[model samples]
Target chain A: MSQQLAVGIDIGGTNTKFGIVDRRGNILCDGRMLTNKHEDVNCFLDELHQHMSVLIEQVGGSENIKGIGVGAPNGNFYNGNIEYAPNLRWKGVVPLASLLEKKFSLPTVLTNDANAAALGELIYGAARGMKDFIVITLGTGVGSGIVANGQLIYGHDGFAGELGHIIVIPGGRLHPGTGAHGSLEAYASATGVTNTAIEFLSTRPEVPSLMREHSKEEINSKLIYEAAMKGDPLAMEVYEYTGQILGAALANFVMFSSPEAIVLFGGLTQAGDVIMKPVREHMEKNLLPIFRNKVKLLFSELKESDAAILGASALAWEMKD
Target chain B: MSQQLAVGIDIGGTNTKFGIVDRRGNILCDGRMLTNKHEDVNCFLDELHQHMSVLIEQVGGSENIKGIGVGAPNGNFYNGNIEYAPNLRWKGVVPLASLLEKKFSLPTVLTNDANAAALGELIYGAARGMKDFIVITLGTGVGSGIVANGQLIYGHDGFAGELGHIIVIPGGRLHPGTGAHGSLEAYASATGVTNTAIEFLSTRPEVPSLMREHSKEEINSKLIYEAAMKGDPLAMEVYEYTGQILGAALANFVMFSSPEAIVLFGGLTQAGDVIMKPVREHMEKNLLPIFRNKVKLLFSELKESDAAILGASALAWEMKD
Candidate 1:
């Protein structure tokens, strides 16, 4: 086991996951806390500090920790701040990295959750030794991180890779979250799958569907996936539609940066070939001649339970002087 | 003049322009040759060598030349080959850079013309000292070069930034060149401008304009610009629609890479505020709040007659080793 370790923290809307991680991406110690319980940001920081101290002691004190890396909803790598993250309930910008650094007396780095996931892949997952690739998370909302020329692309403002917002179908689906019409998030996210299932039921009322028996309030993505597994035709059609939309968008992304692989992660990938097959077919069909068969579609190799912690710690490791 | 000068060559379908350029971007001597005259690439190269030898002697000799950089239709920077260029008579994968290196005994590098133009902007024109930006050429067809993290995004393949081929409208317009439906190039290119005018005339027969008088052959982007300059309503509407399409696409591009600036080049920019106003309005309207009003929309600063040569030479200078 590597004696050197970094602390990784992933701050979500409801909870925060923290861990002490080795260079090889093992989470030696871990903790979690309710993020929204404390209304004040400083109180949240104090809670975070208290928990970190315990983990630091377990790893033989602060000296064993090289630095801290944080992944949050609106984290800014350049400024080390989280600005106007709607889900965080914090007013304006939060200088989370500075606060952590001041308390721990160690270096700290911050990046958006998707960017952290990308760094995680680069350090210890599928993207090891690869110079160019993209990681897309199809969870509640869609998120992405772009890597090119062996470096994370932190554009002019430290927020370059927002692939979810790219309009895949003009005047098509409307995103309920961001109000951006025709976004990839509107059709490919977990919520998008549930919403698409709902839309299909209403639009095709005359058609028979297993989903129709469950009603809109009861049928979620999990229910839809279960139905599809049971060979429900309407449920299968929903996955196919979602996959086609996602695949078409992925084709556009390939045209933009031409990454070697596009790694899909999160709840939606659980549908497996029900989604991947259509995505592959449409992405290949839409790609230009030069890029037709070159790009590989991959799944996240990192363990789901430990990925966020492992990914964040990788960024911390990079901050070593 | 500096004793060390790089040779820049711009190979087009019609003509081949070559020049000796100093570090300060000044063209010391220049020459041109008809490209299609020779069916064979070697014959074309020999003629080029004959003319270049005269210009090389005018400065100093082969010793004075630092290296040769070429900008061609389908130039591949990795392999230094022009691969399957539809416009060029050269059959599959002509190793032009290697031939130039063998004959001149100098370091030679080649890249796709748009990428060369991006290097030109970075080294000698608008994008100096900038870390992230995009250069878009809106001429016969829409072409782009993306720069992020202070380097051009070449993706996994040598060709990465083919922003023109991105599907914007989904099923809107069919690209004559790539066969992709509803592409930005189909709406923003000069031919697109002409096509849009024809389509508008047919769709809204009641709409009056000077474009209707010129017939299809005579009504070009230039003629449309002149009509818009003279306050023709139909022509103005055509520009508005084109700008709207371009603006929406730019918004999507912004979401993808979050560039500091998107530099517009080529013939369409000459339409000026007539096109720029709607582009700004729609681009801003479509942009997410985080990126709103942040990205500057600028025009290319390199002089048209000398830009291609200068841009190519900039790439040559970068390949000093």
Candidate 2:
């Protein structure tokens, strides 16, 4: 008999990614389709099934496949639904997992993208063999997935580990999404880095920044990282400020759960030491004495392009019969 | 055959309370001794064993007791040691569980006081049968114990769930105990309530109130609660302020772990609606939409005096061998 494989699917606003994966976390076959083109959830799933069915054939047919796992915005493991995920074309609650299972005729499981990312790290990346740790993704917005006692904490509502929405600054920066002040996401995300740079530039008109040459449309976290690498002081400060806020928030997270480590993933972490040094410094500075130096801060070893699909696939491997 | 019983011990700065409790959570006998006078942990353990031995005899004999469970400041469940606990008279690392086992000739388990309290609630109090919940103790200082996926999270270091140390207000109030500024403990504990009242009074000297009749030393949380009950605006404001801070912090907690309920325990909770109303309101106000109404804020049902002892005994009952 052929070795068992699983189908990993990631539902994004623009595109949907699906891959056939082996038990060892290898993506055997990969495929993608434009999500926005499919206005209906059923159309999207039908297209995904067609794409995945071909991938399974390439990897020696459905008999070799085990199950399907999905990761999307606002995915709920408890009900296997994606409820009010603003990014998705699906409106209200969509029974995504059941739809996928009905199409593919396989066991299926679902969870939020951040939880999938954490499981990805736990099964095949930085958190391997770790029983207690947190994976924080600093992307368009901050997202987190907590793993304790070798299990993902779905909480009472399958929406646990929303660390980004937590008010780290308490009435400082106002989050546009949640409308809460001083949230970690408001200051530490890609948009946050951009907001910080714009805010800093607005306050001091005389500061010579490479950012001034570009229109606001041209500015982003990637461009900011390039500017900081070129020794732009303002660009450097953006990363520093972001890291300080992130580090302080990380300290709070450490104190709350006392994880063995915290693994950072996403675009902001690309700044490396610019974001990490201050984060490490402030996290340690803020921790209670006993918790000091005990938590290992790490960067994700998983490749950014493949991480989401791999993470989603981890959920498939995790599904019990 | 005799009924199996467990010995529960709560070690505090002022006193050490011990009790022999049955499997059904009933106290067969109870006793306590002055902890500060002993000066040494060995002397303390010797006295505790001698005292507990008598309680064991009254319940039948040592053979009838299943095990011993000790809850102390800084207790490490993994190594059974109390490391550098500020409140305890014993200095440095004290192997507390081993000491009790050596003298008492019974298998023993150890955990921090807050964790024990959570276990007590899980077994015999408000958290009964709930899998995911958080217990926040607002005493002289704030502490917390987190239960997720039906087990107390003894993170990699056996010191998970220290919610009090989580920085709620960045660079805000300073915690004298942890030296971390803007920690939850610095703003929501009994000490914090007194300090807020003092700070409020210092800011508004013209406001005529009953608090003005007492010296700075006489104004405490209990008095503040009484004044709030009588509808003193300034005193009422203190509970509102404390609850606001606590509620905002609770919102963040609900986001992080998404616990089914947050059980507030200890002296500060005595203020009842004066605190609960604001805590619930602010918590909901700060929380994201999905978590807002889903998480319940509850007052612990455990009798304050017996909570510590009951919490410790629950740990013994949880032991596997």
Candidate 3:
């Protein structure tokens, strides 16, 4: 029998990653292209189709391809559409799954990127053997995918698991994407860390730190992490505060999901104890007595590139069955 | 064929309500008894067993009893135990379901009151015909039950859906049950409303109103509602503030569960728009742009007693299937 393959695509604000994955969750061939989200979406889809064709040819032929699975910013599994994703500069709902299916003449499934990552973790990564857990991605923003009773929780409208937008600080700082004040995304994301560092620098200008060496335009979570490793007080404060907010949010999530473990993925999570320590502290402090010490928090074991593609492939694999 | 029946039992702080229901979600007969929580738990169980025996004999005898379902505080569905329920003064985990089964030689199931309530709503109440919704009970304390993907989201240990403990106000106030500071339960429960009213009265002693008549005794949420209905400004502020907190928490819930509707039950919810209006306004204001106007917030249509019994009965019906 010929080896069957599925095309997994992960769309982001700046780039789109596509891969041909097999039943074993291995990527056979992969490629990337600029999203250029500001342009017309039809043009973007056309570009994606061309790239996919080239990848298919490289991997042998379309005959091996069984289906397509996509993970995008505002993708909806039930509607098979991307509905006004802010990061993509898309307006209104676009029938993404149908368009892909029409182009490839194959089965296609779509879901929000966070849910895709969760499926990735479930099939090939940290949660491969776990039945219930929450996967949290802490990149430019905080996102989550929930698994309950061995299935992804896509509530009535297939738009569940927006953990980042939950309130962490009432009437505090404003979150970027949510247009809401005091959201968990405002305090826990990588961008949130930068904003916090800036605020901290503004308030405590007298403290000498490595952050002063970097230009304002170059200030990012990486530089802050480096400084914190060198014992920078302001950098340390940023991580502690960010972790506390994350921990508090996780405590609340425990109340709702009650997962055995909460898996952390994405860039900010790579900061290690600088972020995890405070999050655990606050979570333990805030959790109900019954739930305390019962939930575990862990870092994602999947590579970022493989995680997204694997997640999309998992969706395809699930659909195939 | 013998008619399929489900037994529902709701254990409250003051009373235990029991009912027999059919598969079509119709109640055949219902009864209630005062819960002597202050006495030994074994004695209480004996009394409960006797009452149930009498009712079962009067109705259709043991052969007609399909199954038994009990809803109580701190109940664990997975273990069929009631674990350290504060309201009931239970010292340790009690295998209530097993005990009931042994006594009656019938299949028995158990879950927390909140979870039962959510199941009730799904099977017979306002959320009938809906697969995704959250049921919240705003009584002496706030309790929540979550439904996702047409099933209760009992986490790894069967202890999920503790919505009231989610922190809505960090560093704001301490919660009585969890001892967590600034939890939604601290601001949204009936006790929370009374506490807010007391605080408001302390701040503005000059505002003479109907609340002055209750100066001799402790003020309950009922008195506050009555005062607000009589156009008292302080009482109105208390409701508005409580609703705002409730609304903010609900917004967070929307992000997580994405339920089609949130059904409010219990005594405080009876305040109607006095609580609902502010909750709706704050929820709308805080919702992400994509989720705005997509979810519904409504009061429970089932009578309090009926809901309690229906929820408990639904557990048995669900288990039998």
Candidate 4:
């Protein structure tokens, strides 16, 4: 019980997951609650504090807790604010770290969720020993955290590592969230996969697919994955197309900072080889000879939410006095 | 007279430019020679030494010189070797750095030409106070050096920041040098401009322009610039096309590292607003709202070869004994 612990909160669009994580990445206790339900950020904080108090009390109290770390969409490390996140109900800049510090009476740190995941990778996952690597989260939308020389490239602004928004297919597909055309997110996210499946079914109507059984709304990445597992050609082709775009984007990223490995995380990675095969192939095909076959394409070893929680908590440990 | 100096050498595909640079970026003396005339690197070195010795003598000899820095295509900073450069006739790995060290008895450093140009920008040009920026050399081919957190992103391997080779268009245009299709180099380079003009003239034969005055063999970037200046619609459209592609690629690069600015260098940049206007427009159009209208697009202030030489020389000042 003497071991110091840090509180980590990952604020997602649908759910907010919080946990007490030790330095070794062990989660003593964790909980989740509805995020979008609280239209006001203050109400969200009140509910978050109420639930988190119980977890802190279980772990012996605030004295044992080092501090708090948060992972949120559009969270800025330099400013500690959540600035106009598309997924969040909060309209503008919410000084999340300051709000959390006032509530918990402890120091707090904040960064974008993808950056938090990258820090988690650096602390306890696949990139544990590696100095240069990129962690890409392929969930609701494509998110990436680039680690170069063992540091996350926050760019001149805190908004660096937006790999998903990069236009892979110039004027190809429109991203509903960003309103940008041919962004990697337009074709590689779960939403992107769903869109691709619908497009495929509509365009290639003669080519029968198990995906046809479900309505467009019911058709999702899981159904596509299941169809692929059952050897559905259309479903498999969907992944091939997605992977091709992703692989090409990855090649561009590799050339940018020449990382040691690219760790893919989130729901999309579950497709596994159905997706990984084309990603590896297209990435290698696009790369120059010097860069070819050098970067390791990998999947996240940690559980999705746990990785985010641990990653956020890792940020707390580095908080300065 | 007592000011310390460094020898800066820029090895281009056609010419090798060397100079004696003082600590404050002044080139006291400089000389150029044909790069591929000597098949043997040793003979090249001998000629280089013979020419450089006169400059060194003029500048008061080795006593005032700190070291030497060489910038060449495919020059590796980690291994201090030129590893299989496509442009250079010296095939395979050429240990030019060690050979220079042996020849001059001075500590030597080596990095790719673009990286050298980046360093030059950081030390003496527009990016003097900037910690994050990118330097793009739009010469025979598109070359780039990315600076992040006030340091060049050398990556895990020494060979990072090869932005020119990153594919902007999939299977769009074939790069004769790398056999890769639709590389940024395929459309944004000086050679790429020549190719685009040739392509435009061939495809749009119905269109009339000053470019028709020159034969296919005579048409080059200089001629295209000259024609575009005179309000030739076809030639102006060529620059517009080039900038559109370059701007789109810049947008992708911006998302990757989120640099403060992108400094354009080399011959093609002399087209000025004729090329820059389109690049700025397309880069903005392709970027996410968070990234749009933020990055400063500027021209390199340093003279082309001088910037590379100064940048390479700057590396010498940092070489540890």
Candidate 5:
């Protein structure tokens, strides 16, 4: 009998990417659609159904698809739902997997985006042969997936690996989403870096730099990295401070998961060594003497566009058994 | 054929505890001997061997023992060795498992003390039915054992779960053993609390306290707990502050492990709600909204005297298969 295919869907705040993949981690066909999170969730599901219909027609109808796997913010593997996801303004529990299964008439699974990303990295990217490692995505918010002994830790309620929200500072700046102070997300996310940079600029107005060239609306992590690369002292400071916090957070992560390596992904990580250097330094300084030089920290080898699709696909692939 | 029993050993700074345990987590026999870490390791092993011989003789000899499992300071499961453990003056990697195996002709396994405690808890204590949880022992130093997906995470070299070393404060006070500043051990250990209390007392000499009744040399955690119970404001402050730091640290652990519960064991934890109340409050305050109230922090029910022995015996029981 011929092997069946699985559909992988990654629903982000801005876009929805989907792919038909096989058990071998091969993507056969893929497509994307704009995500209108502002609309009612039913409307979002309707839109998803339309996209699925088109993809089914494109791939010689739905009979070849064996199942569907979804990766979304606040997606719960245990419940097959998304619960009050911050990015999509999802309120309460949305029965996403059930809805998808009903629409497509296939076995379905759903999990938080970070877990999917870690699965992607494990099945097809830098962590291919590794059983233990943490995949951290530094984007709008810091997200993490922890794999220990080759399995994702979903905890009791499927709400594990919320690395971004861990307090990096006791009474430092407040995180917008959680209103908690000193969270890694409050310091390491794109918005986090912006907040830190804004605070730094406010305190050191004398350190004139390219950050002043852009309107507050135009300022983002990319421009900050570019400005720092151009030797802007203020920009350098921003990256340095951000890296320090990231490193400290990673150090704490090391204590718990003890992954062989930490793979970093997303927009902010592109600052490269500007961010990695400080992280490594702080991590080494904080590590127990035995583990000081044992662990490695690396940038994610997976591309952003491919990562979500691959991760989603990997989730489907992992469910084959 | 009758099922065989396994031997479990826990080596600490002062003593070595060992027991013969069955697969069902029942201890058949137990023994203890001085660690004598200052002497040649071979001599220490010889002493351990003698104790084991007596136990085996009582149990109808070595053939009935299937394996030996050891939990020690700096014990490494991956390499089956103990390396540069601060508690032991031993300077090199001691092939502990192999040495015991060679001596007694039994299969042997090894892991750090904290991991052993976690495995023990998983098999016989608070986390017996749970697949994921963190077991933290607050004694001379803070140590943790992480259980994710029903397995202990030894990390790259069995050096994982160094919860005591994670830096709580950036450039904070110096730690006694590592000399690193701001480490959890510097502020949360018994020695740490005493130091902090001393610092607090010197600044407020006029404050009448029960601690004044004991000589500085005799002042310990038990005395501090007694004073706090008598409404000593300084003692209360010390515990509150320690719990706050502990709670903050646990908040970080929750993000990484996503464990259902964090079980606290050992001397410092004896303070019960005096430590747990502040820990819960600070943890809730620091946690992200989604994670708030999701994780439970509880004290260990295992008696301190029995813990190390039980944990080590549990390791033997777990490895019997």
Candidate 6:
């Protein structure tokens, strides 16, 4: 009868973050470990369990925990499995939810990280009262979660809401990961921003830029943001170009479901007005007249690192007793 | 009491089709009138009333008719109004449902034509038992209805599922109606097919075939289909181009909602394999690995003329008694 808490786990390509969260969205305790270091999925689960156990004990042991929720790349909600995730070391389908269920003797739920983020927004973040909205995470790769009528769109196969991969520029830029051409992720994400900076520096060599000070390998979204902050024209144009594409893609999404707002999350949003102005301008320029000026484009209210774990945690609260 | 019937009306740019339909999808009687002949909406309603009255009486009067359902361009389901529809002569927001209810002394519902087609597909067409699917109307203009989790996605403003407007080839072609560039409608509709044929014929005059006989004005989707049927390589390439763009757009749609199937309806589908082969090939090619080959691309089973009325009629079945 003690206050129940939920264990939230986020299994990213490089890091696995775990947290003990109360119903009020507070992370009581948390920790992380390198995800790729464990070659065997079983070893990964064992390491995750060892890390989570200490947090569970701090919150007064397993009795206080309601269940576990996990968010990962290629995670399937319908079947609690991670299916052929390219980023992870596991080469094939891995029964992650059941493994955690058995290891902790608790109910477990799993969904793609984007879906978890959407749920987090619905329950605790900016989309709290809205019935229709989209959450786009502009991190190393772009990710999306679409919510309509207050429910997450898991699609028929639990793999809906992959806005990152939607082809924006028909034969424009090539996404190395998905082999997709002109995908939103190719130009809107952190990696995309870095690539845009490099492309601009090389293609427009006559245009002097602060970004040229860094080598191609040394340049990233953060460095570009820093340069842009210093009123660097070339670095500012990188965000302008990235935002233009992101805005166009967002316009296409708006026409699809007509969501009330689009919430942006992750690192690339750090560019602020430099990016958002173009995103808003181009998104409006591309939308059908009826949808223009209607959808609110907002940045995430949740903290950077805490959002993934919190979003993953939000899923645990939905687990049935 | 006698078996109940529903009155269905489809208001198109040129033609207005209306029918009295039974619960089992049988049309007892139907009629058509010119939609633009009467500029005033009231006059149009009066003319429609005079035509529909005979059909309603044939089905045993208003008492036996459960309700009236209407499908029109730019129709809003939540407000039961037709708002600024480019195709319709009724210029602004017309309270169509209330007007119909007032005139006929029966309950009435109104939705966009595409959404109505989706309902038609759900209740009486290829998507009868499917919980999630998309219905694309490839007519003079492209329109779409998206169904997810056994419900139509009405979005926040009841204007959801405008897949036709989603920019497939950004900055590629101009949609004269919506003024957006490279929209799916600008490339995949019947109009788009003709435009593609014109572009091809003019650009590749050297490698010619059967289509040169017709003037630019004479070129249409039907003419191109006939030419392609006669081994016209240039004409066949028109469908190939249209389908490729359509297939790519469908791929983006599949990623959005991950529907079980995509049901294509309208004039272009009459070409059968010529259009379908490329659509399927390109759609599968563009899809991410997980979604590839999983979604069934189907043609609408409903008869072209009857489908509009049938789809509109299906909405009446949901009316509150």
DockQ of all predictions against the true structure, Cα-based: 0.73, 0.78, 0.79, 0.80, 0.64, 0.80
TM-score of every candidate: 0.93, 0.94, 0.94, 0.96, 0.92, 0.97
- For residues A168-244, write the lDDT of model 2, one tens digit per residue: 87668887665778888888888889989888777867777999988877788788999998989899888888888
| Candidate 5 Cα errors over 4 Å, as ranges | A1-4, A22-39, A206-208, B1-5, B22-39, B46-64, B102-106, B204-207, B318-321
Best TM-score among the predictions, by candidate number: 6
Q: Tell me the lDDT of model 3 at A32.
A: 88
- Model 4, span A1-321: residue lDDT tens: 553899999887678999999877899999999988988999999999999999999988898988999988878888899877776789878999999999999899998889999999888898989989999998886788998877888888888888888888877888767788888988999889989999999999887799898898899888998999999989988999999999999999998899999999998899889899999999999988878889999999999989999999999999875
Query: Mind giving the per-residue lDDT tens digits that candidate 6 earns over A1-321?
Result: 664788888877667888988888999999999989988989988888788888788889998888888988878899999987756789778989999999999888999887888888878888989999999988766778899887899899988888888888888798887788888888987888888898999998887788787788999878889999999989988888888899999999998899999999988888788889999999999988878899999998888667888888888887766
Worst 10 residues of 2 chain A by lDDT: A83-92
lDDT of 1 at B122: 83
TM-score of 6: 0.97
Q: How displaced is residue B278 in candidate 5, in Å?
A: 2.0
lDDT of every predicted structure (CA atoms)? 0.84, 0.85, 0.84, 0.90, 0.80, 0.87
Any residue pairs clashing in model 4, and if so which? none
Clashing pairs in model 5, backbone N/Cα/C closer than 3 A: none
* Residue-by-residue lDDT tens digits, candidate 5, A1-321: 333677888887667888887667667777787765546777887877877788777777777777788888778899899887766766777999998888778778999888888888988888888878999988877788888887888877788888887777778887666767777888888888988788887798999888887777777787888898898999999988888888877887887768889999888878888888888998787776777787878888887767777787666656655
TM-score of chain B of each: 0.90, 0.93, 0.93, 0.97, 0.91, 0.96
In model 3, the Cα lDDT at residue B80 comes to 95
Between prediction 1 and prediction 2, the one with superior DockQ is 2
The sequence of per-residue lDDT tens digits that candidate 6 reaches over residues B181-276 is 888888887788889999999999886778788788999888998998887999888888888999998999998899999999988999999999
**Ranking by TM-score, best first?**
6, 4, 3, 2, 1, 5
* Top of the candidates by lDDT: 4
Model 4: CAPRI class: high
Off by over 4 Å in 2: A12-15, A33-57, A60-63, A86-91, A103-106, B13-15, B33-63, B89-91, B103-105
Which has the better TM-score: candidate 1, or candidate 6?
6
For model 1, what is the error of residue B281's alpha carbon versus the real structure, in angstroms, after optimal superposition? Answer: 1.8
Clash count for candidate 1 is: 0
RMSD of each: 2.7, 2.4, 2.2, 1.9, 2.7, 1.7
